[model samples]
Target: MNGKFIAIEGLEGAGKTNAIKQVGKILQEQGVHKIVFTREPGGTPLAEALRTLVKYGIDDEVITHEAELLMLYAARVQVLENVIKPAVTQGAWVVTDRYDLSSQAYQGGGRGIDSGLLNTLRDTILGNFYPDLTLYMDVAPSIGLKRVRSRTSGELDRIEVEPLAFFERIRSRYQILAEKDDRIITLDASQELSEVTSALRVQLIKWLKNKGY
Candidate 1:
């Protein structure tokens, strides 16, 4: 219960993975003894399997948008029950790559799913579980997609295969979410990677100090 759950969220090539790595290192240097690093859609074994199905377009014939949403929540349920909750109970700081917000943005905003349904699912399945702080890495959709595509050697996955318009919608949703939620902080990811990392570190330290951690 004493743990702080921090989530890094953005589009595909927003440098969240690198930021998480740097943040963890900084926290370790600061003597944060108990820290847990994990990610959504694949945090646990079950979730990892589901992640493959969801991201890789496996069983595409049977995978509807609603089904995708449900599958994501199912994986999240397992991660929350088995990994995240236990780590938090042990007073471990948790840093996650993505979480519920991804679902809302990708499924609801990009895919045109029902917001009411998403809200309902979130309330019933996730309940009061929410991140203590969320770092929303803001980047242009086209730039993010270009970065991703440049790094990929093979075919794109289902999410990555989405059009630029889809990513634009997702980016817009993220900005809206940040504006609506005080716990979410926005970082301009268009800057150099080092600058973004430094900004994130400063924000995290200030957040920790404010929370009396």
Candidate 2:
């Protein structure tokens, strides 16, 4: 893999949609223009169908935890086989809105799934495959929910509608992972937009230089 995979991960309303653009600009300056951007759950046709099934709260039947976990991995595998891996093989950079870490935070930490089981599933699906750089945007759950509410007049998605406590647990897991992993950098996303953009550019540039890009 000459091309790099950069994943931007965080809870809902953590400004990930905009953060990708910043990362893209920094990558362009580093002469990486063959960039492909992908979002979790909907990067391909089959993945989009699974995303709808996993995200929309339809017919009021609770989606079992086991079902949710399987669907997420199913969508992710589709993206990898159909989109991410192919692009990376062709020497194109990939920036993603979310990736494997979401499951670690949501299913494992938030839903209280056994970490051992999660790791087993992850290894089965992904093995050693992972991002070259991962930016975990850290935002307070209260602030994140408020941002989501103010931006939307309609109902929230199934996971996005989870209570504050749920997101708090997810955030805690993200913090722990970012602190422990050198590749995962935690960014304070509660700052002003310009400040956040500048911070992302600076951090990404530093990492790129360190990698001999």
Candidate 3:
């Protein structure tokens, strides 16, 4: 059987990292072996290098929106071929930090890139690789920005440096995607961190049970 792929997605400061960690622990306690946790844009060496360049090197004016979108897929294709597909074929459950939705939200929605182009790239490059389940941690842009500013001590990433309006558009696009996709579970991320984790845990347990885990 193919391994189940679960993806966690949200804006910065939406507690995606913490939630994934907690979910891993919970899965461990449940005696689920072959659980693999990874993140996009950096799951492999090549992807990691691309991630750093995309996040930090804003001076590369050649990295236009189109270039950015293709680069993301390039990394994704590598991850899918080298890590994700192999593990899943080996019956390992995979938890990813982000996936194609980030590309859709950031490049297509936030940057005003054409949705048609994004969809075309996804179809051509990614094909039918869809998450079994996606946990979308939802929060207001203002609150999310405040949390991010308070947590990060270093320079902001290219996406983080975007204007508030950009973030708002991104968040709105996330909401729309979650609403349209039944596989996506939207969670309120504006609540206390502990509370948010608890809710996520509950939802996860329910999903696992339903999946006959």
In order, what lDDT does every prediction score? Answer: 0.90, 0.91, 0.89
Checking candidate 3 for backbone clashes, the offending pairs are none
lDDT tens string, model 2, 1-213?
Answer: 568899999988899988999899888988989999999977999998999999894799999988899899999999988999999999999999999999999998899988998899889998898999999999999988899999998878888888899999999999998899998988999998899888998899899989898
Q: How do the residues 1-213 of candidate 3 rate in per-residue lDDT, one tens digit apiece? A: 777899999998899999899888888877777898888887999998888877876575656777777788888998888899899999998999999999999887898898998999999998999999999999998999999999899988887888999999999999998999989999999999989989999999999899888
Candidate 1 residue pairs in backbone clash? none
Better of 2 and 3 by lDDT: 2
Candidate 1 per-residue C-alpha lDDT over 1-213 given as tens digits, one digit per residue, 9 for 90 to 100: 577788889999999999899878888977886889999898988999999889886653757899889999999998988889889888998999999999999898898998999999999999999999999999999889999999999999888988899999999999999999999999999889989988998988888788786
- TM-score of candidate 2 against the unseen true structure: 0.97
Off by over 4 Å in 2: none
Task: Please give the lDDT score at residue 69 for candidate 3.
Answer: 76
Which regions in candidate 1 have their CA more than 4 angstroms from the true location? Answer: 59-62
Which candidate number would show the highest lDDT if scored against the true structure? 2
Q: For model 1, how many clashes?
A: 0
Ranking 1 against 2 by TM-score, winner: 2
lDDT of 1 at 174: 90
